[model samples]
Target: MFKNIAKDEMNLQDKPMSRFVNFNEWIFEIKTIRAIRVSDYGQPYSAMANINIHGESAFVDSLMTKSEQEFARIDAKVISEFLRQLGIEQVQFERFKNNQPRLHSVSLASEPHKEHKAKLVSVG
Candidate 1:
C-alpha cells in the first residue's frame, strides 16, 4: 500500500525526498526539442544549446569571441563531459545578449621566436 499526502499538508523542505546537493547523478538521454537563435540587439549573437536531459529541460550557452569561437565550441563539449563525470544530473545554460568576456582558458607557452613552444595548457 502507498500513502499519499495532500499538497498543502506536504512540507517538502522540512522532509526532503532526496538530500543530495554535494552529490547527484542521473543516467539519461538528452534531446534537443527547440532551436532558438540567441543574439544581441544589434551585434552578432554567440551560441545556445536548448535540450532535454533525461526528461529534464536544460539550456546551455557558450560565451565566446570571434577568435575563441572555435575553441569555445570544443571546450563546451568537454565541459559537458566534465559535468557528467562530476555527477551532474541536469544542466541549464542561459544566453545573455550583453557584453561577455573573452575565453582564454587554454594558453600556449610564450617563448621567444627562437625556441619551440610547448603544448597547450589550461589556465584558470
Candidate 2:
C-alpha cells in the first residue's frame, strides 16, 4: 500500500531496490525492504521481499533467525494467492503449483535453498 512519492521525499538509504517481472499478462513488482526489529535488544534485519500483483500485495519470505543457515522460504500457498488474484483459474493454478519443477521437491529442512542470496545490509 505505497503511494507514488516525489523522488525528493524518499530517503536515499531507506529506499528499496525494486524489480519488475512479467508473468503472463500481469506485471509483478518485487522490492527489498530493510528494517530493524526491537527485541530484547535490537535485532538485525532479515531481508524482506514485497511482491505486488496488480496492487494486491503480500510480504513473503521474511524470516528472522539467529541461525545463519536458516533461509527464508516461499510457500506455494503464498504464490498461489498471487496467481489467484491474477484471475488464474483453479485448475490452472493447481497445475502450476503442483507440476512446476522444484516447487515441492525442495526442502528447507535438509539443505539451504539454492537461490540468489540477499545482500547483507546494516542500519546505523
Which candidate leads in TM-score?
A: 1
Q: lDDT tens string, model 2, 6-121?
A: 43333222232234455666665443333322233454543323332222223333333345533323323333333333322231111122445221221222322223222333
What is the TM-score of candidate 2? 0.19
Best by lDDT: 1
Scored by Cα lDDT, where does model 2 land?
0.32
Model 1 global lDDT (CA atoms, 0 to 1): 0.34
lDDT of each: 0.34, 0.32
